[model samples]
Target: MGSITLTNIQKSYGAVHVLHDINLAINEGEFIVFVGPSGCGKSTLLRVIAGLEKVTGGELSINGERVNDVSAADRGLAMVFQSYALYPHMTVRQNLAFGLENAGMPKAEITQRIGEAARMLEIEQYMDRRPGQLSGGQRQRVAIGRAIVRRPTAFLLDEPLSNLDAELRVSTRAEIAALHARLRSTMIYVTHDQVEAMTLANRIVVMRAGRIEQVGTPLDLYNQPANRFVAGFIGAPHMNFIEGALESSNGTHMLRTAQGDVLHLPQSVAPGAPITVGLRPQHISLSNDQSGFAAQVQLVEALGSETVIHASAFGTKLLAIVPGQRRISTGDTIYLSYANAPLHLFDQSGLRIATVQTEDGHSPTFV
Candidate 1:
């Protein structure tokens, strides 16, 4: 019963507000990750849940118990910070036992807990070594082991992998995922990296400017974004945006790009209305034909498995991801097109317009 709920959560420092009207329900045994750019308040929201920072407004409940007024130590939560907050002078064994000793647990029980956590984290061999003798990953494991011995209702992790190297981060990320599977306790993690959020979380809460932008499974937000902000934010290399206008031709709706190209639309929009077209780079196909849209290649990235071409189309920069190592080079002209790939249309307000268009001018509703 480690579920957490926040109702109209708001945090402010005098006249400056940070978190705004945050309402989220975290289920027990769920792995939830809060992700956004820096200063978006994802960490602040986690701190609010941990009672490290008092909320200026709203109610926080852990397993149906109100905990806004509870002290951090009494909130039944354990936090692993970005900095491995281990005592440098203390051995790993001592670090794991420090909290239990303060809680006045029996010596036998404290020893048993330390053994269990060390084995779970697989740091038994390094137990006698002080923090100074361990690698960054080992120290982080010790930090996590310290939290594990607490056995709290939920684990709050604040960018715990940010300090590790690229290789270490990937391995440690997997370790944390495995730990969650074994523990099955409610866990809330915060990171600015969407890749971490996509891979680790059962559900991701995307935040921006002190408000929740969207919340859903990684694929849910990827396949069908709620708005232009999310459609551009969720994917790697990002979704491409092209300026266009909605037009009507004899009762048929069409999208006319700024480059004077007209595309068929499946839904009718207000005539002469402005809209933006979003296309994922992977969805675009490159061809030698000059009949379609012509783009001037500005840069070519030949990744081993895929080639990403950065080019300019209709006075706008665009990227197209094609398969395999391409022989194309910078300053080359390439034609681009797509087939059956769904296009994301955004209105003037940047909200998704659910209209699927085809080459035959027939309208099919996009799911």
Candidate 2:
């Protein structure tokens, strides 16, 4: 029963509105992540749900009961913040037991909860040590143990790994995922790193300018983006977009890039209509022959498993990812060909438009 629901959620600061029209339903035990750029209102929205801030409009409910007026303590939730908010003078065991003590739990029950948390987080060896004696990862584990000892209905984490080094972040990230699996309690985590959101969340809530742009599973958002903004934001090297217009010859629809390279499309569009063709770096194929678009390689990055080529082709810059190693120099000329790959088309308003035929012989509509 650790569900959370929001309806028409809005927030403001006198004259400036920070969050607008946010609506979502978080199921019990589901791992949800709030992700966006800084000032995009992801953290602010998390605070609103935690009852740390007042909602400017709409209603919020937890476990089927309205909680907009509920105090932060009464919401049956625990939060782990970016900073390891541990008591400097208190030992790990004392810090873990602090919340239960304040809530007036029996001493025996508090001890049991602290013991379980310490064991679960693998911090039993450091229970007698103060925060000053612990490493970054150890302190963070103690912080999480403090939250876990409360046995709350849901957990709210706000960039809890930001303070750790890269290696520690990865390990802690895996630890958190395992914790979610073992406990299966509702968890809402906020992070600006897409990698964390992709690996941690059951569903990701991508926000922008105080608005939710898209909400879906990581693979869903990656494979079927709703718009240009989402397509550009979800991938690593990002999707490369080439400005072009539609052309038709003998009922065959083609997209002509600004550099005069023609691309055959599966869907028919209005002739001479403005359209943007999107190609992911991995989708672009390279060839030694001159049959494809001629391009000059500008740079080459030889990662152990794959090579990334930065090239100028068809009057626009492009990135091509190739398997294995290729002896490609910066000044080498290569032919680029992209065939049998999914094509993303966007109009002037950055909205996705689709015309490819499905197996049922009908074109699907874009979202």
Candidate 2 minimal-lDDT segment of 10 residues: 357-366
Per-residue C-alpha lDDT of model 1 across residues 83-128, encoded as one tens digit per residue: 9889988999999999889899999999999999999989999999
Per-model TM-score on C-alpha atoms: 0.95, 0.92
lDDT of 2 by residue, 140-172 (tens): 999889889998999999999999999999999
Q: Which 10-residue window in model 1 sums to the lowest lDDT?
A: 355-364
Who wins the lDDT comparison?
A: 1
Model 2 local distance difference test score: 0.86
